[model samples]
Target: GLGDHPTVLYLGKLSRLEGSELLKGIIEEVLESVPNAMFLIVGDGPARESVERFVEQQGLSERVVFTGWVPHSRVADYIIAADICLLPRRHTSFSPYTSPENILKAGEYMALGKPVVAPKMGGFADAEFPVIPAEPEEMAQAVVEFLRNPRQVPEFQRPTWEVSHARLQRVYSAIGAVSR
Candidate 1:
């Protein structure tokens, strides 16, 4: 994950299967092209210790900041503080489907007016957010583009949660009344 500046931030637990290495590779490439960027990782899990060790071994300790386990209520603070929200969900043979809930929430971040840069896999590909291919290199490039010019991202149009609930009320009324 990158930092407050133009950097690649990974906001998830560190795990080999979660594609941390792939993200790291992408960040390295991005740094090569744009030397000012950095990486930021939020959250902690079973893989945290190993990932921190790897960061130290690879001399990326300065580039990465591990926030450990953040509470759900406080999670949004991290998201809101970030220039971009990242969700690099990796799929396996056993993993049958990708849910868009994360993408939707990321969209919420965009609705709050923050540009998102995530892989176009699972539900991410279908989200309203401007998602690109799942390649690490491309992901880095995408981040670069977004940070450079966030206005190009898809505009946020979804109503707030309250508005959505009100719309649902209308749906219920129509369903119960039957189409005239």
Candidate 2:
């Protein structure tokens, strides 16, 4: 779960699906729309080096923070520390199966009462948060709105992991019954 921040943020690797190139443009647009905006990027991947080069090339070296790949245990702390949480994976059918844990993490963020912004797609359809399509302009605008008025996003509801385990138990039982 990414934490909500007063600053505009883009976390995660620049995978082809995540649209890393659009982030720089979106950040530029967001800054233009909202003053006092900042951008933080976490994680490293095949595109990390390229993204760093691009950030330098675009002269955004000062405006963006790159943390490289932090350990998984430390990810939650970073999310909790931010003002807004961002999960900008591209929308795809495979998203549900591949990224359901992310939606769950978004719920964790919500439980902590942080506003989350994610692309509306598989795995997240059932999860909570302000889901939106994967578009930089729209994302930029959403970041501006969230920053301008953080309270606008409703309170988050963090369910206990035990409850989730129970729900999964029922689901698995139902599946087993059907198979039987």
RMSD of each: 4.1, 5.5
Stretches of candidate 2 above 4 Å error?
1-5, 92-98, 123-137, 152-156, 161-180
Report the C-alpha lDDT of model 1 over 40-97, residue by residue, as the tens digit: 6777766778767866777767766788877778766766666666666556674434
Clashes of 2: 11
| Candidate 2: tens digits of C-alpha lDDT, residues 1-180 | 123325544556666566676665676766667655566777877777877887787776776678988887777666656677676655455544437556665666666556767665565545444543344346667766777766634532345577667677888888895342
Error of 2 at 111 (Å): 3.4
Per-residue error at 46 for model 1, in Å?
Answer: 2.8
lDDT of 1 at 180: 33
True lDDT of residue 115, candidate 2: 70
Taken over the whole model, the C-alpha lDDT of each candidate is: 0.62, 0.62
- After superposing candidate 1, which stretches have Cα over 4 Å from the reference? 1-4, 99-108, 130-133, 152-159, 162-180
